[model samples]
Target: MGSNLYDKVHIRHLKKLGDLVPDVHKAHQGFAEAVMKDGVLSVKEKELIAVAVAHSTECPFCIDSHTKGAKKAGASLEELAEAVYVTASIEAGGAFAHSANMHNALDEAADDALYRRSSMEHMKKLRQHAPEPFDAMMRFFQTATAEGKLSVKLKELIAVAVAHTTECPYCIDIHSKAARKAGASDAELAEAILVTAYLRSGGAWAHMALMIQAYGEE
Candidate 1:
């Protein structure tokens, strides 16, 4: 194999891991299968969630795998595009939401707390500071979360999954509640969380091939 860091062939090394760590590798495979199995959410929905999380986690292998999985499960290109936009909006929204901390630091706010719920109140200040871009971002976010090819419930579920990968508490709190309001059950929410967990770990699992290759170099 060539020295390319992210060649498709590199992923073939994942199979060798079974010989080196049979028990843990087997358990990881089992967990991945169990998480992606149909349950409260359909296979198509789970795959869509995986697609969104693969983007959030920036895992090329997971992105390629889940994007194909999503298509095979019957997701249309438009639906997959919407899932990617959902990931984009959430990733951007995390930074936008954190601007409150910037505002706090500027004011030398005495709370000394990093992420108070009340900090969100300062979001308006961003609007006041840069009305054009701030408003544009808000419009994009609204359109991203709004009903389209994907239902709001599914979009919100995707948002919750992406939020976990982003580790954005504000997005998690907001979207979890929005998901419930859109008629997602606790079971569904838990499944979405599990999908996020699997994909996050799956990223590392997929990258194991890179580490193995590096170790083999003379």
Candidate 2:
């Protein structure tokens, strides 16, 4: 009704529908609480994962909410910043990783194959031409995923979650190995992925409140 349509106040509209769908509303709330509680990963760790996945989802509501949650859960500003860059690296990495597809497409004798590990060799050309930016990205990714306040193991785990969300096989392959190398057990990686699943689903669930407001207005 004003200059902008999506203000924080719009979230309250979900309560107006509570009586109509009490069970569904309550289930969503319960699931959110259950997933966010400390498990194998602490709440602080979970919130950081949420922040990373939130960036991949590009859900402003999620980014805002989880950044606040991460801070409240005792994630420092540096930790939060590092988490965001991890997300960025994976997101951009998705694009770079998929360049293998283009390589396959360009080769006259490339066969019908759409993907192969050998296709990644095409990336070497970037080192020849776009050396500066390519090297800079590599530096940033290394720095971001390196151990600081957050361990390399944790950051690699977060990268795995984002790789799943992005559906990038290259990133998954690279980070999974990196995660394991950094001492992330299979169980810890599994738990991080479950947290990712929660945040991905939760992004859609959180936006339903906005959908309700929009529909009511129409």
Candidate 3:
């Protein structure tokens, strides 16, 4: 198939990945299966996390695949939408959260410590800089994360997982606290983290197809 950088994914290349590394492919499949199994969280919940992490990786393949998985696992479109937005918020939050570093760097007299809770205050500057969009995002985040079909606790748990994958300390702090307040146990939190681990790894596994195209068969 003739394709360029912006073309929709040509899935034929994906099948070739199985041929490229049969063992690794098989193991990855098995790991994905095992990871999604019901444990502290249900498979429906796991699929939601998959969808969320897929957004973080910016992998269209994983996003579509796991959105279907979430639907099949009994997730409503509303629930799926919430999960995707949780991802959006966390990924967006990563950039917003890391702005603390920018704030610190700007202060010539600031301490060597780049990330301080106090620096989060600098986010208020957005209200002055981009009032409309910043306020809109905050409102959207509140709506996306509020109690709904998935429950605040469950949403917070998913947020925690996405935050970890994105490595946003502010998001991690905010959502972990929310998760705990919503009665998420340490065990449940751990399971969510594991789901994030699998989904993050699954992204690389899914992209082996691109590698197969790059390294054509012998």
Candidate 4:
């Protein structure tokens, strides 16, 4: 193995995993194929979602693999870039949206509940507290999500996928509604969520290589 932690060669260890556990490996492969094959969303669309979710998961192997898959599926550079920006916006937006919790924590009268859907209304207080940064984040989010190279529907779908990977309920709720409004079908939304689910698992699966390396060293 290379001295670097995540060399491309490390992925080869996946074969060893398959050799060790053929049934589970084969099942995983089947599930991946079922989720990724064309249905409500095209293979290209699924790849784009995979790319965004891979970034959200911060999986080096997934980022590398799904990017290539996206390209092979005829995703343009512009489309892929837009998908990445969607991931960036959702990640940043999750933090921005969660500032409501901070406001609640600072309030002496606030209830003990850590996460109230109603507390999301407190997000408005951020603009009053820091107008400039708040406006900037909003502007960046608007730019990232607005239709350009990718359609609004596609961008919203990507946002939904990344939100699932980020495990942000606020993002998932917001983007899922946005996705529906943008004309995404329930089936399409379901596929996007599945893509996120697959990639998140694949991240851990990929990191098994690191575990194998550690065990070998010991």
Candidate with top TM-score is: 1
Off by over 4 Å in 1: 1-3
Off by over 4 Å in 2: 16-18
Clashing pairs in 2: none
Please give the TM-score that candidate 1 achieves against the real structure. Answer: 0.97
| Model 2 lDDT tens row, 1-218 | 44565687777876765687888878877878888888888999989999999999988788889999999999999998888889998998889888778767777888776666677788666677788998997898888898888889899999999999898988998899999999988878888888888888888877877887778774
Candidate 4 yields a Cα-based lDDT of 0.91
In candidate 4, stretches whose alpha carbon ends up further than 4 angstroms from where it belongs are: none
Worst 10 residues of 2 by lDDT: 1-10
Instruction: Please provide the root mean square deviation of candidate 2 (C-alpha atoms, Å).
Output: 1.8
- lDDT by residue (1-218, candidate 4, tens digit) is 45899888777778897789999989999989999999999999999999999988899999999999999999999999999999999999999889888999899999998778898898888899799999999999999999998999999999999988888888888999999999999999999999988998899999998888877773
After superposing all C-alphas onto the true structure, candidate 3 shows an RMSD in angstroms of: 2.7
- Candidate 3 lDDT over residue span 1-218, tens digit each: 34563234655677765776799878877887878899989999989988988888888778878999998999999888888888888887788777778777887899987667788888777678888988897897888889887899988998999999988888898899999999999989988998888888877766766675556634
Clashing pairs in 3: none
| Candidate whose lDDT is highest | 1
- Whole-model lDDT, model 3: 0.83
lDDT value, candidate 2, whole model = 0.85
Q: Least accurate stretch of 10 residues (summed lDDT) in model 3?
A: 1-10
